[model samples]
Target chain A: MTTPTPSSPSGPSRLDPEPTPRRDFLGLASLWAAASTMLFAAIGMMRLPKAAVLSSPSKKYLVQLPDSLAPGEAFEPPGRAVVLFRDEDGVYAMSKVCTHLGCLIKKNGDGFDCPCHGSRFGIDGSVVKGPAPQPLAWHKVTRVGEAYMVDEGVAVPTGAKEQA
Target chain B: MSDSPIKTSQSALGRFWRNLAGAPRAVWRAAFRSGAPTTDRTRSQFVFNNIFLHIHAVRTHRWSLRWTTTMGLGIAAAAAFLITVVTGILLMFYYKPYPEAAYDSVKDIHFVVPTGRFIRNLHRWAANVMVVTVILHMARAFYTAAYRRPREFNWLIGLGLFAVTLGLSFTGYLLPWDQLAYWAITIGANIAQSPREVTDALGITAYFDPGGFQRQLLLGSDVVGEEALIRFYLLHVMILPLALSTLLAVHIWRVRKDGGLTRPADADRRLGPPPGDVYPVFTDAPMKTYHLAAVVRGRSPAVGKGPENTVPSMPHLFYAELAALMVTVLVCLALAITWHAPLKEIANPDVPENPAKAPWYFLGLQELVSYSAFMGGVGLPAIVLLGLGLIPFLDREQEGTGEWFGGPGGKGLVARSAIFGLAVVLLVETVAIGFGWIREWYPEAPQLLITLLNPGTLIAAAYALYSMWLVHRYDSVRSGAMGLFTCFLCGFIVLTIIGTYFRGPNWTFYWSMADWPKH
Candidate 1:
């Protein structure tokens, strides 16, 4: 530890007792009041970006399965992230969003390929290559009489499918 | 009182005339406290009196005025930034930030608003110029080893300035809301999300995803849309400019505090001391004997220096600064007049541009991303930036502080490093392009392995090995740093050129644009 030289300016000294305790109490109370106000203000400010209502495309969308779609073929609904597939196993929906970064994967032949990163997923939504740790997610598909309701926000088991 | 001097003017008309006659002198005096600087003392006072000009020292080393030393790159960058600010503010008058109106506003600025196109073009050209000049300025500082001793902090600040410069450029790129801007920003946002690669590989993304967090923070959502446009606009117009200006002030202030610029130790002797010593000899007899002077902890910049080699900054330094600013303005104006900043069709999210490229500066990174997204975009850039930040700290030797390439031997080292770097990058890219990566050969390859062993990582590893070899050969840290920096520079240039010119649709390699298959 370094000691100050004789010529050096001295460090802080012991503080004297408060001359006006009541005044000090009042000042402290006001300071706390201001601090709490600011804290609440900051908390309120933080809530602005976490909006209660978000202006975005609805996650749950209804997509009509194309009648012409053959077995094992995928049909991507416009403005939706899920790809509906019709196979002998019945009807299923796989999310086209790449698990790696979120670039919409294109259906390359039977599997899906990410354009940003080369992550391939099998037609069954199984990871066929590395870089993409998880397989393409399977979205919940509920049979709605004529059209199927696909929930893009919900992920189900890989083989879960709705009866055709 | 009225009888004194010639007959005093007692009338109101006479007083008004006298006040009017004295107004010019009063205004001039208020602006410049000192008169014309005929003498050295007045010249010093001239600088000291002006708040704006006082950042510069009264006396500057004649060597600093030499064009070959710094190449005026710093001032050029400052000039370009100034031009950018002026033109940016002008464009802001008619330019809207909303996604709905941003594209049309840019078109109006391009074709409708009088002189708006010119202002926008100038802003664009000057911003690019600023980036280039700032980069070159850093290169100048590095090759000269100016980051030694008292100037290391300033060098770090310079790096911060460079980063802010790039940030400004990236943010500004999205304001037009065109396909180019939208797609480039999309690629940029994706790059920000590259941390997912590692997190996913480790099977930890479900619990913690920093990549996604960063992307959300940057674009305010998953993708570049309305939120992203507004966020980038705020950053471009306000936040980044404030940051840059604050850092720039400190940077220049530190330069003055650290003694104008780094110069040779024997600079005064080399230049043969300005005409003669301006002060009386104080080192003689009684003054030396009576004064009890102790060695100080830090260097005394003026120690043992006669005043002969230093010239007043009044005309010399100001003249040089003015010339640099003028040249920068002229070049920017010439470019603005000749070219129209490109604006492609408005952004269409459904129609993704094939082979979508990031801005040219980041194209090198994009090329690396194609190799391995996480490694190329995030991991390697982090490593490179960390290495750059550590350069001055690692190479602490104070010798060869002012000469280019750390003295004569550095020239050969830099040349060799550049050539080696160019060859290594080309060879690695060529191999990767011709035969493909391990993943291409083995479909079952692990991502962790691929991330650690791609063309980007290979080139970086090669550069590190070359730098190590240089350290061993020269037995000097400076030589190693010089090698590494030179190699990195060359690699970036090569990668950027290839990314811009060679890569085509689906990121396939082609010799020329003509050879690329039509979409």
Candidate 2:
């Protein structure tokens, strides 16, 4: 056994400093792994919602149309243009939207008047007033047996015949 | 030698079978670097050679493995952390960190992705479990006196790990971007903002304010917005986990250096004598005398105590941990599959969640803030932490190191302290009701000073004074510390329960949880 010298510090003792620092390579490697992961995540985040798929809007509307538009009668569906006109042959569908500015037209004497831009249309959607450039566009109406199925996506000319 | 064709073919097939079964012996030796431990020498070598098993000691104390000693809280915490990391990584694939898209992306995750909801729920619940079990781990360490002497530094590291665990939870709370997530984080951020309250009350914030410093540092703007979202995401994903992993490595290493846990004095004697070759004697002198003379740090030779009352980490601890991991993962998965995580309407800043809670844990602090911001947010929390940090330094008695509440008389002392602690907590809570006259006298005083002179702080100081007297009376600060720690825990639990259930809109008091509105 070696006796301790007060002045000498060297030893074959188990009093040497730890191997703890030597194991720090594990920690450093873990951190580097974390840094690289963050970089990859950053790169991933750079790719935006560019490939997001938006669903297209449906083009069909189910509208109930009675046999005829008698006097003081109308078909004003909520959120849809009201179609009201009394014809000798049958009931004719007229758009309540003014062609002048696309504002909803209210019922008037023998026709409709635009609340927004002061444009008027005859009962058959013919322009009977100024500031109205063309007649109201017609939504092609198809008879689905009992009620009318309007092709709202396809708007046709007013005087043209409505499809069955 | 006229051999039949069928017999000759069978001989060739036998050769193929022998080669298939016997091949890769060289490769297996190269990979393992050792044969299976049929002997003691090989068992030690097998453990030391493997990268994964090297962290665990070849042999461990029976007490350390016993259910009551640790209750497997620390292992559970570690296992929960593993779950969080795995589930969190999977979640990162689906989560987008933008205000407008964050909520929708989460919605898409719920409605579109398969098993995505389960992953997210498991991540959340695992985080909560991690936090709770970590606190329980700390309590176990304290009660067992594992933080005594050489293990004190490890205590500080453990404290850091606890804080980081909470930080992990806080950062994750904001990711979902629902009204609940938004306002919950807002309440937390607003709590962070309370540092300015003291500074502003003092009128010196123009020069420097650390509270405002933390606020601006965290939030790029006045409120929780795009920058806050990104910062929280980065912290949750990378910065905190990296810190936790490093600290955990150090903590485990230090545990070995500190002489495995501070088990009972005769734990090794109970296991009979140490095995001869397994744990070869390392030093000529006593470890105690050597350590005092010269601070030497390395792996303790006491690790290989013997296998009678100890077992190999290879199969024993590893299998136990695996069982814990399996149970935790299954429970979290079951919870995830059965109940979905909360995702209220797309975070509309226009519509606020009234009486917006700051998660259940922080609701205690929030409730305190209702009484006083400085005391609740900063002062009281500081006191609790300082008290905990000062424990080892204050209680210098090592006589009762490995026992609960300190020594043989611990049960009696703790029971007395528990009674004292509960009474103190009750007195602090209800003192204001009795002291209505003080409020009447100070009707026109500044609210800050009114909060400064709150009854909770005074009653607590009085309790400390009384406990200090008892410490002198019994000649033991350990008893005092026990009383204070137990009191703080009771107060925290009570306040959290009250804040979570009984507190209503506008911070009004209600009789029970049912009294609160359905919303």
Candidate 3:
């Protein structure tokens, strides 16, 4: 084996390196700045919200019902839109959108039937059969003195027991 | 049968013209000098006859069949990539990136566009094939120690390419924007984003954060919408493709630079010179080293004659590669034509999907996630990927000279041990992941262990421990590390494959209630 000469300067090893050059530092900073600027611009364009269109002008209120509808009595409005059902407690409004594919469900006997995918929902907005994963969401019903009010914003969860 | 020199020249020119269809003078010169020129070599010569070819052409002993197999796998992957690109472009003509138009465009493709179904099928099948080929390529590389020194950087780049490949697959998954694609990508992106947590009495944040960067760079906003779709589209079609292509070029170039595939005799030949001076004095080494080593080992050196074993690219490997490429393309086309890509109902962002499944490649990890909040959430897969990326630096043994088992050139007990150990670890992990899924589907007796400790969490913990032990053992005892690492790698492969095959519909999460709340 050859012995090392103490006086001689060692050659640069493969592992060791030096600090970044001024030019490289400047170049990297400029590149980063450019990339960030482009990213911010793109994001700004994407987040620019467009004006919402009013599709159904005729239907102002989702559903308008009498002070009370008796039990087992159902109200199917025009356009096969929202269905209003009454029980001893209050009036419940459920949209026709099927849980499976958003197909409008029609009243078949006691429950609603989805024409597109054959999903079935009971009178209480509970799923009965077919491909629907859960019961239909029930809108909140308010007993305004004697009359009832349906709030579309307060959509109730389809409880686990309601699933087919 | 010896002909006069003039007659030979005439015959050569005639054959050249017939083969090349009116060859130019440059082609003639190259053919004469190189014996027979391949398309790649011909193109190389045409471009610039410098050191580039030296950096591009793959060199290996003919009998080191694994290298050829690897190249075959890579070509298969490249073919799949091409298919995906072509089909993706075709789909792009009909697809709209916006949410409102995305589902409608898909409907149009299925109903209105001519051969749209075929295009969709091609894209799907090609994506699947790309995933398979990449995995196979990595496996072959590991087995052959192709990731060893000088090629270490290339190995890291290979890992990057693997990541990009998966990214392309995952991102493209959402473009259809159907129920399956939407929920699948959502779950996948969620898993991709799941925080990396370390377990204690209370959970601690891991050093690295998962999905944080992905959220910023990929999603941009909180959810998958127009922004996500556009970003994924650009990445799938342009950014990833360019990056992968550039990296692939560099990878191949490095493979050539590192003197191609290592031969069994290379170890013995390298033993003659000291480790430091082995490269430059390589040609001066005694030929006896190769002959004697091969004879003693009961194996013949694949390359004939001395160390200067070189083969012409044409009519041999090039033909094989071309044949492979053609076969790949034909198979992809056939699949594309036969099967229609799945497109379920339109994606309604307000609705929740049930049992949301990630892409197939990530199923193994997803399956793990279902078992425990901790293991599937953060621990094992992260460590594995990070470890894989760091493999090149860990295994610093010089490729050509290292022995199998001991010292400089022997295939000793250490390598064998490593292989077997890795195989065991893989087997255990497979059983663990599988059992975890089964337990989830059918609960075992309500016991403390069953309730508190999920199989996924246990398996992940075991895997993590094994990986840590592997690194430690390898460092402490040089001989056994190879065997252990091999075992670790094999375990992952078995787990992934078995997990993929067994999970059935769960692999793609076809259940309608993907995101529905389960009591």
Candidate 4:
């Protein structure tokens, strides 16, 4: 217990001029504990959305290329995110998902055109026109027996092809 | 137990009749804790004691009850919301929140369940009505300058409620899982992902994109599917409603604390004293002590500003509220009966709707998005909302506080602003649609340049410059705010109308839907 002094005219209280050192330490400790608790809780919440197991279909699928498909033609598998192209060199896969906003692009006469925004990708997946910053991504392709397996989850370098 | 000694004079039958005669009064007293309110004291007590009526002030200004004052828009909006809640609950009992079954469930509700169709229609119409009424209510508050002084926080709360209302509507729009719902939500989701435009242009989207995160969180996946349906349903049925109700409680409480609905500061002087004034003693005090709920360090201006020209809220204000509510319900009922809510073909992602549009309210935003994805959808709306939030603080002039268009000179200013705003919006839209923009002439233009120089940005810039000129000319912040707000409001209306009616396939301009080429 301290008596009121000339310097501290209002009251002889621990909080008058400033909190006592012990009180300040305790307050700081409590604040840190509360903040860390909130941070951990937020981190815990972030883990919930990334499920270990997904019920949806896998992104990697094997596509049987139509025998009649010409060397320079593009064949898009129904309901899949990848479009397969077989040329004289080999079979390659390009992502149907637009580089701009992820709208699946439709195959035009010479290239691909995005329906959402008017971004156009050429036959080789290079951006002919854009709001699309980069060209369409190329997906990893491997020959699984006669059918080609395109892995949408893995991006391969542009023009990388599975040898025919 | 036998009653014999005290009832010697009365027969058994007479005693029973006497007991029955007093039963009604006993029940009434038990329920109300008071007699019928024939006097001002009882009426005040009736309002103060009742839980349902307690949100209202015990005494309401007579001016507040006028048809022109608030136009009962707030009450109507609340009533419409109530209707939506009741009907929405009924809908939840039968409606499934799964992607596979949602459309089927809606179809069953339409064709099978007892009065489900009517309830669903009512819910749809009521939600629409709530949106319209809420917007009109906001417009009313703005035009009358009711968002001034102590009521600014309440205005912000009201704005929050407005946002929650739209959130509720947008979430509900997806529950049907039809083509209309699917495509509309897709367009909306894309708009939510508009920040990718900026990120993409800057070549940082691969590492960082808040817009993409928002869209993913909203949809619960990359697209509107099983996860999106459940997420939207949860938000629509539970989270948003909870938020809205809580905000509404605060909004109404703030209204009470702000000393009821605002009127001109000199309203009492103009109207003289109210007729049949019984509380002369309460009103006549030079320094009303009842208002001093707390001790003050200085001379407070609120010392003598007691309530004026007021009537008991029980019969006067409550009656008006009830009337407004009834009118709203009747109108909704009429609309529900006359027109059925639309249900389109089941959602097909592969075969997309050619001119896929968002809900009517978001059409204005969608129209903007057609010009430039990021600026139109994200930037412009953000700026508008920020501007709206800052208005009360910026225009601190409290002179024409509670009058329509801020009184005489204000009316002329607003009119001029509206016309100017309309002209600017139309001109910009026409030029953008007819002649094309920067992207058309400079095909190789940078995405950032095109994004920054779209029709939406042009209109916004024009409006800003015009409002600043008005401010400089009038030498008043309030007038400037008024001009800007009116211009934006006009632009919003014009854009919405065009988006809803004039635009067609591929978002191309059309005079009418009749002119749209058949697929």
Candidate 5:
């Protein structure tokens, strides 16, 4: 055999540079698989909801009342709106929207009191408290040819008086 | 040639005088050898030829000098660490790591041993200064972008160093075993164990339950007591220091590898040819001819010799670092002599502490814990910290622009917008937290309004979110400015009105015994 020449001024000549070690390949493969699995798992976890759902039955009630109630009289309905009248027998359904801030008013004794700001409204929807400047809003109840249907469409201002 | 013989002799004499005064013949002989190819000997010759001697015999940047800053800081910190080791050894002579002896040992340090207080204070102040200096150095590196490119790995190492610093501080904090250290560390560890609130917000839980086993492993028992003191003592003295020193060496090595301090261009050029090239050799034979020409012009060849340039970590840097070390040592000594670290009454494991506060750095988080158990306890803070740590990984661009967001070069508009939004949210939350109790006391007018604003804190948070969105969409700068102003104002209001004025004995529970039945 011909004399093998040295690659450089350094020691030793390699014969067919040693094949890649099997352990290195196995180690690299395992690392790759582990990393991929962790990444996928993290992404999957992000889609879950953070808050618990509330379970209460009282939130679903609806309100129903006669077309119109007389002024100075009030209607406390379970579902939709609490009504307060401004004058006797002359019907008016006052929406319970509290004038103090916009919280629904609860009827106390002779008038309506706002729980949020403590604003009080008289039987006729007049402002009785210092915090609330304006009276409670009165809903329009038109007599459509004696059928006694209350018009829930229009809101009548508390200051406006209907002509007979 | 024959007519100028007298002139040539005079020139030769003048040249000899010049070489003697400045560039000595011996220096030339050391620089270049006769009958050798210049290229073959260029590298070695360069080192000896230059008057401004450097180890590498090449030019480099001046900002590279700040690497010296890091090194100097580390050395100073190490000196403090050494002091701590010596003092700790001394204390161990009399001190016991058991709970029974820990407090007694502290008392001995204060009242019993001669100059024991001095040793203890020296350790404490050195630690405090080390932490502060490390932070400042980090900030300097961050602003200068010294952490960019090849240096990123070192930055990570630095982060590890920072962690070690914190660990050392924490473990040392408990050595005193008094009320302040005990409660503060207890709260601090609790905070660490609690899931970060931000992470919870993101609905992510890498939940690994740390049972009593883990606690025992960490504290050497279920609670912070004698076992904990011993464990902390070991960690502070032995484990962390070893880890820190090992990492510090690696950190310095990486800096050397990356390239010495980044300097202004002019300063860099003044050093010599750029790094890697050998400077030209000045041989005695050539020197004699050059000197003759210089003598003919009646000028000294070495008159314009510039200031010496050096590679970082070389002799020049070594001296500067020593100077910095001296200053640091004197400061540590002064602090050790005058001040005593805070140590409260002995801890009673049976009594629960009221309104338990965390360490100062964790006050923001502790305040957060007061919000909601789910949000404050687990969600928000975790996300914030994780996100902060992940910033470097997320912004991986190659550009050197100093914008806070995105990979290096892109405009930081998105990042700025995000920061602004976050600022707004924080401001709003502060206000909400501050005024929540007041609003709770004064219910809104209508029942509906009360329902809407009953959790006034939530309303404030919602408002803050909305404001952030607004800033993101339109007024970015204004958003940040307003958000900061609002947070400040709210903080002031809370501190003055709510915290100082309204928080009474009922609110400010000093010890759990205040509320506990005295039977």
Candidate 6:
């Protein structure tokens, strides 16, 4: 549908096929030849590394009991960003993040409180105060050995009794 | 059947490949619609047919091919994006944006998971490199005046892409959930409260109270929590990247449609008449040529578009792309091998870092915020971005572009602007620090005056006014604008370096980073 205009350099007014030397064809052909050679070389070099470098291991973590933690106390995993409760009932792992704005709540008397604002949650992770839209999340705690593995992806309601 | 001696050897393997490629003819038809193109016509056709090559023009000007012309920064940025996408997806496999698991997942990646740390390093480093390279691309375009005339809208789009690039990086900053990520983002979120500072300073703001708007907009609440995390995570992983990719396609397409990059101003004298056949035909005839004439600022459409000086996109552009990508990947790999991405303790809001800082990109703003939050964080950056966007409209002179600093004293101008800018910024900073000392000594100065009346803002305003006076003195708005831009860039560089390394406990100055105690 489109054509080059005569005023432009690409139109019918500009084609001087007679002026192009035959040797120009050789140069043009050799350009492709050189490109293909480089292409093969690059592919050959990249292939081995591409094949060898990839290995994806699964990300499931198995929690083991450390010497510092015991059965009757609440411990926040220094790295895990979760608060674990180990009492007579069961071992519970709750998300330390305030459900309202996401700031980690500090442990207060019989409850937790947001330091940024003042959203409060009970010891079992239920919302005891306003501004916190919801309760702190309870997670799935599975028993691997003597210790418990807490899966933070799973969420549960407050006061639900679950054993690891 | 047994083959002949020649056919029985490597020719047999060759024949097999030939048969495989040629089989049933339909397989070949289904695959390479433009097959084994060797000639110029067929090469152009091949490029036209291929989806990848469709983004590129069939031919490119010789100047555009020169490494110095672009310094390969844009191409390298694109290559870095490719690396980011690959590595980001891999990182996402182990990453969860949730609060409890996020920090732990980072630790696992660092210590336990196979190649998780490696991929994270690649993603982090490549993302950083991409931001830098994109900025360099903007600078290259600006210095070369590639955003003039027909390319004005493209410049705006490029700015949009720059914003998205920063957004991508900023959102990604919080993914690791370590102390560094937490505090850095906290500082960034805090800086978002800048608009309110001005509003609060004015008594009228007490009733209207738009101060919390920016922070709430960024964080969805008073603080950074789940909503912030999820929002940042989605923006980082999906929305911003998608937007960047879409805009990048359009930006490149416009470059090709607008008749490639603007060559050097005097290039017409060097390039004479181009062969007619080598000129790219548009989808229409006389109308298209007229449009091209309008777009190209017509001398002749093909004046500099000769075949001898140009090359086809098929091999030349592809080769350049491949080379850039290889170099980028190797560099990224080297960086990943050498330096580990920093991950501190998990997020603990109760015990904050002594001098908590924003990420390095925004550290310049943070440095400014220490003097005056609203002006430094919000007003200054807005002015720079808007001013940059308005350059094409503002500087209408036709001849003085496609070269460094836009004049005969280009390099000299750059050096002078740099020195002037640095001296002003440094002097202002030292004085501001000195004022902090004065406040400590007096203990009677109003905090409000200290907050808003710092010498930093005063010096910056004075510098801007002086630059405008230069515009009047030189009778050139373009020259004036260049001076300011160079000044701002130099100031930004100095501020970032200072903020990243010098400040210590209680936000006090340290002579060297090594002198700071390792908490």
DockQ of each: 0.23, 0.01, 0.05, 0.22, 0.01, 0.02
**Which parts of model 2 have CA positions greater than 4 angstroms off?**
A1-164, B1-28, B269-310, B431-443, B459-463, B517-519
In model 3, where do residues sit more than 4 Å from their true spots?
A1-164, B1-55, B58-71, B196-217, B265-307, B350-354, B372-378, B398-454, B464-519
How much is the TM-score of the A chain of model 2?
Answer: 0.55
Error of 2 at B41 (Å): 2.4
lDDT (tens digit, per residue) of candidate 2 on B1-519: 356644544577797887678779756877987788756557767888987667777766556766676777777888899999998888878899998688888888878888887778788888888888898899888877778777888988998899899889888888889887786676566557566666766777778688665665566554577877887888889999999999988887787678566677666675565455334323444344443233444345443332355656656666777877787777777777777887887775543465567667777776665555557767887777777777877777765777656653477766776676667656665654334323345434554564576545664576678668668777787767666666666667777876787666545556776786674
Q: Write the per-residue lDDT of candidate 3 for residues A1-97, one digit (tens) a residue.
A: 3344344357754344546779999999999999999999999876553213322224324455554556667775565345677665456677665
Identify the candidate with maximal DockQ.
1
CA lDDT of B435 in candidate 1? 81
Which of 1 and 2 is the better model by DockQ? 1
Which residue pairs of candidate 1 clash?
B273-B308, B274-B308, B274-B309
Candidate 5 structure quality by residue, lDDT tens digits, A41-149: 8877643321122221232222333456554456665444446343533545666754432345667788876543345677767765523434676666554554323
| Candidates 1 and 5 compared by DockQ, better number | 1
Per-candidate Cα lDDT values, in order, are 0.82, 0.68, 0.58, 0.83, 0.52, 0.71
Interface root mean square deviation per prediction: 3.2, 24.2, 11.7, 3.5, 18.4, 13.7
Q: How many angstroms is residue B326 displaced in model 1 relative to the true structure, after the best TM-score fit?
A: 1.5
Which residue pairs of candidate 6 clash?
A9-B276, A102-B225, B196-B211
DockQ: which is higher, 2 or 4?
4
Quote the positional error of residue B209 for candidate 6 in Å.
3.6
Candidate 4's residue-wise lDDT over B381-482, tens digit each?
A: 889888889988888887688888884358999999999999999999899778867756776678888788888898999999998998888878888888
lDDT of 6 at B459: 56
TM-score per candidate, chains pooled = 0.87, 0.67, 0.58, 0.87, 0.49, 0.69
For model 5, report DockQ. 0.01
RMSD of each: 5.4, 18.8, 12.4, 5.0, 22.1, 16.6
Reference interface contacts recovered per candidate = 0.06, 0.00, 0.00, 0.02, 0.00, 0.00
